[model samples]
Target: MKMNNVIFIMGVSGCGKTTIGKLLSEELSLPFFDADDFHSVANIKKMSEGKPLNDTDREGWLKIINKLAIDQSLKKGCVIACSALKEHYRFILSTKLETNAKWVYLSGSFEDVYNQISERKNHFMPSELLQSQFEILEVPANAIEVSITNSPLEIIKIIKKQYMKSEFGLFGLGVMGKSLTRNLANNGFKISMFNRHVAGVSENVAVNFKNEHDELSNTLAFDNIEAFVNSLQTPRKIMLMVNAGKVTDYVIEDLLPYLSEGDTLIDGGNSNYKKTKERSAYLKSKNIYFIGTGVSGGEEGALKGPSIMPGGSKETYESIAPFLNAIAAKDKNNLPCCTYIGPDGSGHFVKMVHNGIEYAEMQLLAEVYVILKELGNIPDEIADILESWKASASSYLLEITIDILRKKEGDDWLVNKIMDKAGNKGTGNWTTIATAELGVSSSLIASALFARYTSFYKEERVQLNKLYDKQTQTPKITVAEVFETYQFARIVNHYQGIKLIAEASKAFEWHINLSEMARIWTNGCIIRSTFMEELVEILKETDNILTNSVIVDQTKSLKPSANKVIAQCALAELPIVCMSESVNFFNGLTTADSSANIIQAQRDYFGSHTYQRLDDESGAFYHTEWINE
Candidate 1:
């Protein structure tokens, strides 16, 4: 095995990339270059002067680094140190560099790096400037992360071993690798870390000793890929934690050989579910199990209790479910974190779907807030309203969002700091894609998604702003009328969005256990609401069970006020989508659209058959084919 063609010691500045890059290069008898050295004098001057470099400023530096890596690839491997922070930046470097570069992402916490940088002997960069570097650093996903806790030499040896094992290989070492190794060891399952350098596997995880569970601190470390592969227990499972980009792709290639039949590669990142499904299928054909799982609850969530959605072959799930479920988040029922949501990319797929629903639910709430603030001219007291709603609501996420909206940091309300520009992870987009693929019209959900996108175009919205421009529908003289109108709007939005979810489920055959879905959303998931239980009951019975029917029947005799409120709301603002629920209540109750003889005639015309008397046993075809023409 030869050294990697290119090695990058990457992280926020002051993480020892330069020192380690040079040391490793000398050990391998390879030429080493400080990535900082390649930066144009101007860029460094800006950083040293305490200003952040934007995308344009970093381009030339990346080009130079890429050229250096390519130039060194022809000979023995080379090492360079730079803060290759963003996914796009890494893409450019990886694409341009000819060398098969194995990244060494220097890992440390804010305190660890701050203390180190503060104590440095002589550095032009101030500790104050360190935050900017940390802010810019996008930790490389699927790279060989070298946690700085061990002596620099131990880290170096760990990487070197992996490099020597493969002619050229990429090892993914991070969150999962670190603790997974420890667990494997405990289970007598040998494992490998596989960093590019000779160093041990890096625990890229930020251990919170506060939890009193050191499981976060223990992870597998392999000297190298060869060592990692050689030490693999039968049915090896390597879980990845890096970002989901080209680096992840590169690591999959790196681990191809180390995996044998029945080996499982679990992509434990926020990867696109479709790709996961495809990859899982391909790996399975080669007799490897690829589980695309959605891990929620975050770092501590991962260390102790995260809700893990695992999807793959059932056999594979059985093999890993025990361990995964043990670590995943628990619900009120204390069910394990591991849930077999579906098949193929089902776990990740379900997660994406879950997130999409979350996006829609959140956006809907924001719409309510906007209505309250701009439309109703009400003071922003989202927490108060949300708190009251929670008594009747089960949506755990919404409850928190409400609290967040109510929270005030300093004089500023958190909702105020949250730019109206609603953002999204690809899950919302993925949901759109899936819904489209399934031929389901998720109009309400899609509208919610678009609503967030529209919020981002604040400046662009100047020309098309509708809050005041579209209409001047004056409020009624009564304050009671104003409050009543606003409440109606909220109710309408709620019913419409929920109705769409039910309609889409049927159209797509998601076979969603609406009751369970609602139950989960009540706490850990989004869209949990007190009214959701009622909605679940309605949907669980039959498709014809309408929301308005229940409202009208229950409240009509007791509260004429309820009917008057709906009537007043209808006259006030015409939220068209919401009309369907009310329309359903009066659907067959009215004599307008349903007459017995009229219905019979319509049925006969459409079916080309004549309706017989109710007492008759059979009907006759009209035989009006020629007669009608």
Candidate 2:
């Protein structure tokens, strides 16, 4: 299984083998070879007859691949392309290699490969024999399987990570790992990783680890857990992101003794909140530093630096923030991808609630999309509508939606081909638990998460089709003009949500920055808005304005249009209705309680302690009508 100095770019002929392999070799600074250029006259003649290649015909080809591997092992790196059609052929060549090497499997489905084959005229292999190639094909569990669907440049970008390193010992190494490592190395962070298996890591990674070079490079290796830990520069800060719960416990139990007192452990996984708190306390009892950071942004976001919500000691979180921020995605103002949410389980708790909001926002967006696509029958210009809406009521989510409409998935559009099914993790469930404990309500986020859960029941939905009509009642509008109104509404909802968070901060005594939080989230995390820069400046000009109504009163001119976003979301068919509902929920606090009248009545009834009111010069509450006169 140790590839001895042989990098094979294996796929059927039409898979950009020659072109991509050449680029890969140049990028990795390796030699290049192609198996297509090695075909014998007899083999070409038999394959031109539409006959399938057998094990006998492949032996010579496999020998050539082995020779190429041995020859390239003497040099630094090499890229060789071959129709490594069978498990046995790959097995023979890997066993015969002189020094360790890698294998990049350029792969696609049979239908896709056959289509490419059919287009070629001068190729020795006929299209009729495509099935036989698939029949012989066996995907090695260890091989780096590069999908053929992406363009050569995208593939090349992924491959560029092959020569980079990840820092601070982190999560999954597939898309997330590669992207994180590449970005961090690009930003100058030395990283070490632990993996259950070693196949995916390359020789460059192994060399980087051994040499202890100062500047970042793709210094990595897949090793046994114990060995991997031993290889690290000590007083280690290991960040684990395997599955949550029991696996976390298992890894912790195993790693406890090996780590010293100054060493730290950060759980970057989505573990339960209570569990994280308990685990942190437990680690502290053992004199170990424990941190729980909540990471969001899917694979792309993770690797590209996600919005990280870290909670632990004031010490440990601060220690890691520099590296974490360096790799995280920027907000609108291009700040780091993270914030210190607070102490104890605050980071995970915020993350759980953040995910809850994510669920609601996504569900709301989906509902609107359905309303537009199914009900409005809007055509190819979905991007334009999304763009117009963003002029005022803008979010990164909406901006991405606009851009997504422009993407093509082969002959069909990506937005068009997507199924109604959505995915949900358990964060919404966690939010429900937390909200119940804290005596608060968040119906919108909860509803959105539940909506995704319901997406799985297509069978039930189909059965329900008999009972109810799918037709939706929709209000028509000139979308371009309505966006101006919607933009105002979005800004209102955003500020309201923010104010609610500020209220929570005050009630719970977290003392979070309303403005800095906005600035920190300007680039990397979800919910980024273009207004964050101005919002931060507003905070700088008048601190605590969100909590101060005198300043809020000063915004009377902006209030009418600002409050209209909620009104619009309600009247219009957009999802901001939930957002609008929150506004009503929050602003409704000033309703007529008449507590002053009641208090005065109580005072008069009890001991004659008076109350002052309109048209009163002195402080007094009238005991009787005659007394008032």
Candidate 3:
């Protein structure tokens, strides 16, 4: 449900809640309510006589303020000055109204509060009763606590940052979801978490998440979906980190009843773009915003900071940008690695291509390691070479690759003992499918997929290896050449991925900024590298990257080394799928004339599939009668 734009400035007596609340009401153009105005005559008399009001004496007073806050909020929103000193009292005031009320705690030292109260003239809350108020005060964990050291305007600025308190409601306490909740909470945004309980498996996931992260004071966890939904500030932002397909749909359906107009549902899982598009349309019909967001950086990245791509309405993005930017990873310039990608499924589409490039990069690294090993390089030598590469071509994947090579268990290297079979998570295949549909050549990525599929036939390959008895032949190639070839192939793979994104943007009208996309990928993503930072600067200068002089010069300088490496690998009968495919792709992309004209003629001869002659204008179809001639 949508939260009221009400700001509740709360604290004990003499904390300046009324003064600050009045100014805030003016600043926000909202009506102001003071709890003292609703106090009963006997209650005011009791407080004025240096006696603290008991719970019974305060109950009626709180209820009236709560009603006023709710009523005013429903109309034009409001700011309430109330001394909601206890957690239970604040809960009653907040939940009873069913309004997403933001509580801003005007916290101060006891000495400060007493000094302020002593200076006040004809106030019902006496300085003598301050000690009793302090005794009864239970500081709110969920409220935005602003120190009274600052001026009213400064306090308002701090409160404005926390204006969207209870901003994010995350469903599904899986690894990614839990990490994201902690990340947001750590950034001072309040988040409520929920998870569906299974009989034996995930019954205590939410409970464990709450208990483990109790130190994050602004977080709330609930076993019930309704309570989770009720706790969020409106327009409610609920992110679903469940499984990609039907489970995500089910969660959205379950949340639909408790959700109201303007509430947003975010699918943060690796959902198919088609499904995300459909879901976005479906939610829009009901007047709810739907964001198909892609969150990268795995569990560790999620807990710390991740590269976030959010695709939805621009209006919805602006509303949620504060929380997203606060928790996203920062680049060298300390800019957030989060942006509004485009409308509908663009975020998911970009993330899918990212995963595809990740597959190709990993496969290329593996192939290089194999080549180095066959050339008689030890694990330590391989590690040293890769570590050296980090100085020039730094990347998260390369750094980790060096670490993996250097790791040893007892006397054995860990890489030597690992299984050869690789697993697939479907995103790589999705990338290849999308490329095919777009008629873009992503042979490197496709080959990486095929390599994984081939690796899965381990038992059959093992038997065939015994029958064939292949010999290890050292290739006549230096490590420098191999590195150069790797660098070129890596650049080509990224180019292909970016090309796919560009094509999709044109086809879907996403209008995604390639420069911004590159900038966001400079941190917190698997393929994040020094190259991405350089690419971002280049993209800012010119959109026609292939023809850009700087990029073309780099490609030309690297071509000879890449060609030599590929030729040596082929001569040695070593399978270098990604590298070979990359070279072939580059050759085809830059070629002025290809053998496709002959293939077109054959097609025209076999069937009536038309061909366009070189002399003919483009798009003018012609069929040659070869048999009649």
TM-scores of all models? 0.52, 0.58, 0.76
How much lDDT does candidate 2 score? 0.63
Between prediction 2 and prediction 3, which has the larger lDDT? 3
TM-score of the candidate numbered 3?
Answer: 0.76
TM-score of 2: 0.58
Best by lDDT: 3
Candidate 2 on 508-563: residue-level lDDT in tens?
66666656655665655565666555566666554444444533553444445435
Q: Write the per-residue lDDT of candidate 3 for residues 278-371, one digit (tens) a residue.
A: 9999989999998888889999889899999988787777656666877899999988999999998999999888899899999999998999
lDDT of 2 at 319: 57
Give the lDDT ranking, best first: 3, 2, 1
Which of 1 and 3 is the better model by TM-score? 3
Clash statistics: count for each candidate: 33, 21, 2
Error of 2 at 188 (Å): 2.7
Best by TM-score: 3
Q: To one decimal, what is the Cα RMSD in angstroms of model 1 from the true structure?
A: 22.8
List residue ranges in candidate 1 displaced over 4 A. Answer: 1-213, 221-232, 242-248, 270-273, 297-304, 374-380, 466-523, 527-629
Q: What does candidate 1's lDDT look like per residue over 1-629, in tens digits?
A: 33245878888877888888888988888888887777788887887787888999999889888877777775676888878888678767766342356677778998888887887866556788788777777765435666777678987887676444322111344564344333333332223445545324433222222133343233344445656666544446567766676666787887787677756777777788678867877776788778787766444344445556676666676556545644555555676535665566666766666666566555545544543443344334555555555553446565666667767778877666765567776777777777687665444456666766776888777666564474424323233332333333334434443444455546544444545544443333344345554655665664433345774464343233334544543555523232223333343344474577666677776776665565555653342342444
Q: What's the true lDDT of residue 521 in model 1?
A: 38
